[model samples]
Target: MSQPQAGRGTFITFEGIDGSGKSTQARLLAEHLRAQGHDVILTREPGGSPGAEEIRALVLQGDPDRWSAETEILLFTAARRDHLERTINPALAVGKIVVCDRFADSTRMYQGLSRGDLRATVDQLHSLMIGREPDLTVLIDMDPDTGHARAKSRQTAEERFEDFGANLQAQMRAGFLSLAQEFPERFRIIDGARAIDSVATDVAQTVSTHLSSVG
Candidate 1:
């Protein structure tokens, strides 16, 4: 179960709403890369590091009334900071390709939708914390209703943001599209509504081409 170690590798992150298959596709890409004799490290956000996992539980546990808007934002950022130091940056330093399930972009989507004046917050946070952003962000766009349905099918009880309401989710869908448009060079927009295989194919092709270009 040891992954091959390449001389130098890239950092890739998959971002999307729950059930958009970001995690599944992220793993597939890492497996493909690993099979190709590349150094690949796969991890997920809000819980990648040990400290972050504790925060992740609280975030997902749904003490909505107890957790304030600002508290939620800080907790998320705190998790990301830990994730960066404990996993992401270290892997990148070792020339290992880090294929992360989610990253800072989720903050922009989630906190942005939850709070107002998102544009300003994103810039400040980027400059203050996430020193380096993902070279490529694969955004799987999907409807919240459909995604929630699929996510629920696999789980018994929905927790945390599962109750984020239709309006907030609708904003997330639009926000992701707008983000892709605004940062086309950094984002690969994939239609997550497609069949699993179809979406995987699209992502593989895109990542392959990108790797070739960067290589």
Candidate 2:
């Protein structure tokens, strides 16, 4: 679980089950960093670049079982490849912090363990197509039932995954925790069940500590 080299800029990612407030926290962190005079690019996976966004609609707006697990792995990988090429890489190359809402880890959980025993396939494809990992990953951990309730309240078209119910969400939460253990060097687990600002404070401090350590 060696982290990718720190290159010119830092790459940070937020991970959690749906409605874990990870997206909000990612935005908050980006804004906080920018206010501190850091050059930052706030982006999201499955939709960072034009091409990836198109693929995002296809995968996120369909039936719960719209695509097979194998198909999803391919689609996610393709979108990630496009995102890396068109958005993430260039920003990092120019020494700007890239804060992504989600990354390959999502695919690894959604299409890998949730659907089947495909974690190995996800890793293989990631290694072949998208070789970079985040310099730091902020994982917002939450209770599955609460997260599911929050997600369902959104009423967005991208509720395909949420439709899978809280059971899957529980599985995803466990899977993410396992991933944190697997990649301890880059994963920082934060409690997402608290108040929004409180969680954001923890996230900010976690990232601040990571940046200082890396520098």
Candidate 3:
């Protein structure tokens, strides 16, 4: 992990293909940071704020082909705008670290790469509408096959995204890795294939190091 300048609230996000345990790790890291006496808010994307959550259901449920890739991107961007204004920005303004399960990066990978070759459009929309990035993005890297197996075990209406299958997961993994390379300063690529505790410990240590540097 690398150091970031202190003096403001930290924004951290966990990203990976579905079933990579990003949600669990996000929760663990939040609890760890809270126990250490830091103000922390753990949230997720496409649905962080109330309005975003409604969008979450709209995007995650229904038929797999409910919305075209471009339209889907719009919905996600709209939800993200709501989330940033109502949830993320407010917490950061109050000097509280925000641990989000997913952020714009997921949109970059899921809609940008996996769903279709819409990376250019995704980037354009992000730059125009949501230009913020996390202070630290912990990417839980793992094999797509493992992620697919794990995702299958937990059935939900959100299966729409998961229906992309293993091939897309592989593409998403590579997309995330590319993001890590592009933003080395704030991206922490963790080996998510390891045991839960091991990965948790590594994530916690990375967060602690960044906090120490910034604090």
What lDDT would each prediction earn against the true structure? Answer: 0.79, 0.93, 0.89
Query: In candidate 1, which residue ranges exceed 4 Å CA deviation?
Result: 1-8, 156-158
Between prediction 1 and prediction 3, the one with superior TM-score is: 3
Ranking by lDDT: 2, 3, 1
Task: Give one digit per residue, the lDDT tens place, for model 1 in 61-161.
Answer: 75445576556678888888888878887788778889999887788777755565565666576557666678889999899888776665675343566
- What TM-score does prediction 3 earn? 0.94
- Candidate 2 structure quality by residue, lDDT tens digits, 1-215: 33233358999999999999999999999999999999999999889999999999999997998999999999999999888888888888889999999999999999999999999999999998888899999999999999999999999999999999999999999999999999999999999999999999999999999999978
Candidate 3 lDDT over residue span 16-113, tens digit each: 99899999999999999899898999999879899999999999987878999889999999998888888888888889999999999999888888
Query: RMSD in Å for candidate 2, one decimal?
Result: 2.7
**Model 2 spans with C-alpha error above 4 angstroms:** 1-7
Position 185, candidate 3: lDDT? 98
Q: Which run of 10 residues does model 1 get worst, by summed lDDT?
A: 1-10
